[model samples]
Target: MLRHVVLFTWSDDADEERREQTLAALRRLPEEVGGMTSFAVGPDAGLREGNAHTALVADFPDVEAWRRYADDPVHLQIIADHVKPILAARSAVQYEV
Candidate 1:
């Protein structure tokens, strides 16, 4: 399987409502897009200082499935509509699990 992981840092002005909105939008992706074996996303636990604001992990059957998820219109729309406005930085990786 392939595991996709992403970390996001929010802009300084990001508020709870905006963050919640982004998370809620992301939570809908698995239903909207296909080929995901598993998916999870959430805000940081605050157990460590300087951690990214949020993280997402998704599992797919193969690179093709991951690619489909990457290019999915629903995912793109969520990023454009909910994430970009408040996003300060992002890091992501995909690897065999």
Candidate 2:
């Protein structure tokens, strides 16, 4: 299996409602996009600065499936619409399991 991980920071003006919506959008990814075996997210509670506010973990059967999901149109749209507005810094990592 392969794991896809993402960590994101919100803009300074981002609020609770928007964050919730962002989480909802994220939670819907596995159902909307194919090749996702599982997904999980959590709020970042560390008090340190320069920390991401949220993180996402996705499990895929293989690299090809991961690529298909990454490039899916609906997922792309969500990234452009709902995600970009609230996101500041972002980082991702993918690896075999």
Candidate 3:
């Protein structure tokens, strides 16, 4: 299996409503993309002061499957429409499990 992880820090002006809208868009991915074995997303619990504001973890059967999800139009649309505007910084990692 392949695991895809993402951490996001929102823009200074990002508000609760925008964050929730982004989360709602993220929640729709499993149904819209193929080859996702598992997926999860949540806000940071504030246990650590400098942690990213939000995070996402997704499991795929293989790198190709991960690629499909990465390139999916629906996913791109959501990122562009809902996420990009509010994003300050983002990082990701993909590894074999």
Candidate 4:
């Protein structure tokens, strides 16, 4: 399997509306994109300093499937139109599992 992990830190000035919009986009991803075998996304609990504001873990059957997900138009659109506007920083990793 391929495991993809993403960490996102929202801008300090991000408001509730922007956060909700981000969530809305994420909620649509599974249905809109293909090749996602498992997915989990949520805001951080803030149990530690220097943690990102949100995290996503998605598993795919293989690297090709993961790539399909990465290149999905809906995912790209949401990242560009909604997520990027309020993002302070982002990090990600993709690896075989």
Q: Which portions of model 4 miss their true places by more than 4 Å?
A: none
Q: Global CA lDDT of candidate 3, please?
A: 0.92
- The sequence of per-residue lDDT tens digits that candidate 3 reaches over residues 1-97 is 9999999999989989989999988988998775788999989899988899999999999998999889999899999998899999999999988
C-alpha lDDT of residue 82 in model 3 = 87
Worst 10 residues of 1 by lDDT: 26-35
* Whole-model lDDT per candidate: 0.93, 0.89, 0.92, 0.89
Least well predicted 10-residue stretch by lDDT in candidate 4: 26-35
Report the C-alpha lDDT of model 4 over 1-97, residue by residue, as the tens digit. 9999999999989997788789778868888885888998888887999899888899999989898899988899989988999999999999988
Writing each residue's lDDT as its tens digit, candidate 2 over 1-97 gives 9999999998989899999888888888878886888889778888888788999999999999999999999999989887899888999999999
- Candidate 4 yields a Cα-based lDDT of 0.89
CA error at residue 30 for candidate 1, angstroms? 0.6
Using lDDT as the measure, name the better of candidate 3 and candidate 4. Answer: 3
Give Cα distance to truth, residue 96, candidate 1, Å.
Answer: 0.5
Query: TM-score per candidate, in order?
Result: 0.97, 0.91, 0.96, 0.93
Which scores greater on lDDT, model 2 or model 3? Answer: 3
